[model samples]
Target: MSETTMNTATGATAARGRGAVALTVARVVLALFFAFSAFAKLIAHESAIESFDRMGWSHGAMYLIGALEMAGAVALLVPLLSGVAAMAFVGLLAGASVVQLTLLDPVNAIMPTLLIVLVVLIARDRQDSTAQLIALVRRRA
Candidate 1:
């Protein structure tokens, strides 16, 4: 191959590699954030219970939600795990936001909306990471 052609190919390859790295880093950061939140809820058992009670859910349901959140947080760290956990949290937050609005309370909805947006950003980053992984695999094989 000509020298100029080789340099162009090299630059393209480097660019792709950099993009993939950036995406992976973003995913890792997002996964860490979700995991940390879940861990906090689990660790502060009493606080979670209190939160559930305040929300008007039965104590049993509160425990269940805490467990679910922990599970979802762990799932976010695993690649190719169907992303169900992340999706579940996203839905939960979105629903909470709507309920907050229905109750004619603004504060109840704002935080949930923020949380939902964070989840969506994580999901988008994850999707980009997955696409890059697939492309790399295809390039190799």
Candidate 2:
């Protein structure tokens, strides 16, 4: 192959590698944030319960939501499952944002809205990763 062609290939590979690394870092950060949030809900149930009560939800609902968040956080760490987990988180965050806007101050919804955007970014990244993997598999076959 020509030197220019080789250089172009090398640059493409390096760029992909860098993108994968950045995506991994983003996934870890998001997972940690979700895991910690879930842990707080589970370990310090009183606060979660109070928050749910204000929303007219029962304590059991709080526990259920906490468990879902914990499961989603774990799934987010797995490449194959990350997209699904991020989608779930998007839904959860959307609901939380709506509740905050309706029952609490509009300012209270900001965190959930921000989390929704973060999860959307993760979901898009995961989709790109999945597409790359499929292309690789097809090329190999």
Candidate 3:
């Protein structure tokens, strides 16, 4: 090949490699973040309960959120289910962000940003279980 063509090919390969590295890094970071956040909530159940109470959620809701977080963490670690779990966690985080905003709760302002990132990562996984979830809902209706 000509020098120019070889250089172009080399650059393209380098760019693709960089993109792959970036994607892998992003996935690992997201996985670790969800895992750690969920573990923290599980390890500090009382603190989560107290915070939930202060936020005016019912006890049942508090327990439910905790359970979901724990489940999401486990799902994050499981390759077969990670995509679905990531989606669930994204929704949970988004809902919490909305509640915080509505209640004028400044404590979770950054949560929405994190949730957005999680949504992006989930999109990379190509599961699209959202469609299935919607279908299930429609069937019940």
Q: Name the best candidate (by TM-score).
A: 2
lDDT of candidate 2 at residue 63, scale 0 to 100? 74
| Candidate 3 per-residue C-alpha lDDT over 53-121 given as tens digits, one digit per residue, 9 for 90 to 100 | 677877677656666876776666555565677777678877878777776476776867566685566
Off by over 4 Å in 1: 1-33, 36-44, 99-105, 128-141
lDDT of 3: 0.68
Q: CA lDDT of 37 in candidate 2?
A: 77
Stretches > 4 Å off in candidate 3 = 1-10, 125-141
How high is each candidate's TM-score? Answer: 0.56, 0.76, 0.63
What local lDDT score does residue 15 receive in model 3, on the 0 to 100 scale? Answer: 95
lDDT of each: 0.66, 0.84, 0.68
| lDDT of residue 93 for candidate 2 | 95
RMSD in Å for all candidates: 6.6, 5.2, 5.1
CA displacement after TM-score superposition, residue 123 of candidate 3 (Å): 2.3
lDDT for each residue of candidate 1 in 40-89, tens digit (9 for 90 to 100): 56566676666655667676665565577667766666765324445577
Q: After superposition, how far is residue 46 of candidate 2 from its true place, in Å?
A: 2.7
Least accurate stretch of 10 residues (summed lDDT) in model 3?
Answer: 122-131
